[model samples]
Target: MIFHGMTVRQKALDLLDSGANGADVARRLNVPRGTVSYWLHMERSKRNICPGTRTPSCHRCDGVGLAGADYVYLLGLYLGDGHISQPTQHRVPSMMITLDDCWPGIQDEAGAAIHKVFPDNATCRVRKPGCRNIKVYSKHLLCLFPQHGPRRKHEREIALEVWQQELVDANPWPFVRGLVHSDGCRIINWTTRMVGGVRKRYEYPRYWFTNVSDDIRQLYTDTLDKLGIKWTHCTRAGKEYNISVARRASVALMDAHVGPKY
Candidate 1:
């Protein structure tokens, strides 16, 4: 490896590599016979004659990239021994993961379904008393669920929200349903608005719950009082606030009112 330390020899060797013969190198350097040969042999050997060394990250031969040996060495580099840290739970790479690839418990459930439909294939085709259509098309039943490819980000967001909505709707209690609906719907207070840009009193004017039903409103009020929600109840009867300010105040009231029903 000390052969790497000799700049002149290395240069000569490089020139040699670029089709410069031994005689050409000898002629250029004006060296006698066998001196270049000795240098070449010294390069081939692993003796540490020079102080410095070429610490190339290779397990195979140095100073010369031999045919296919270099390739094997490269392969060793490619397939390294470095260990990867495992996650606390099973972790999948994101890119290759489609909906089908990451279908939470789908595969096992599908397999069970398949097995249920098609128990012991040998007996089933003989048309026993319990030979249902499922038994006839066992393979078809096994592969019944179609392969759903990767949904894009927007699709996934929509799917998740839809799933959540479905879950909420499926709940037995009316209060829970109202709470879920409230979560989805925006709040609006009964407030006044200037009619057609005129500098006068707002056309629509009142203070009532926007989205919530009567029972929901009552429930909200009761929950808020229990949770000590500082809601903006009318201390003054005829107080006029700007539209934006009123909307914000309404939101605050709603937040305090709908503290944490879920």
Candidate 2:
């Protein structure tokens, strides 16, 4: 019996009963062939009766209570700049979100959000040539993010489920925060004006969310509107659109819910 491992003993026994060879079971479970062979000859009922290693958080694999601030926020990040891939003949299902290497703060927040959503599974950070990646494996994500199919975000229609919509309705800040932090920026805007016959420079703060996907941009703006955080949208170079929150009170409002990443 393989102890302290993720392999489901009972499931392995069932696979063996289904006429799969020990090697095949081992390959599927990513375990040693001897481990599969040992479990195949043992007591399936006794092993199942012992206890399950699954924790409360792993329940998300089956699509339980997956609606909340964390869930919505993760969804936002995914929609903004995340990718999900199905298992190949030799791989497991995985989801990845890559961020610019320069932004360690955003990377840390993304890692924490992924861990919060999939607490049962372990997530790892990988460094690519110019970006950092947060990757995790979970087949259950296929059910949660149905919009995770072919093509880029702009080429796809991004829509949320009724439950997800309700979650955003109740807690829109985290959702917007995730979207903005992933694909937006907060910076100072300076302008020159004439005051008392002298030219003076003034500075103000603004939040800008830019995305290539119109549907996603709409979703981002819709959520901002829901929270009553006033913003303006304008077309940027290429197919991108920029949504700006520059009003004094509006900037203050966003600052409360979503501050600088670092």
- TM-score top scorer: 2
What's the C-alpha lDDT at position 1 in model 1?
15
- Over 4 Å off in model 1, which ranges? 1-184, 187-217, 228-250, 253-262
Tens digits of lDDT, candidate 2, 87-194: 886234788888888788888888888888776678998889988888877756776677888888789788887867888898899889889878988899999999
By lDDT, the best candidate is 2
Q: Against the true structure, what is each candidate's TM-score?
A: 0.17, 0.77
- lDDT values of the candidates? 0.31, 0.78
241 Cα displacement, candidate 1 (Å): 25
RMSD of 1: 28.0
Give the TM-score comparing model 1 with the true structure, all chains together: 0.17
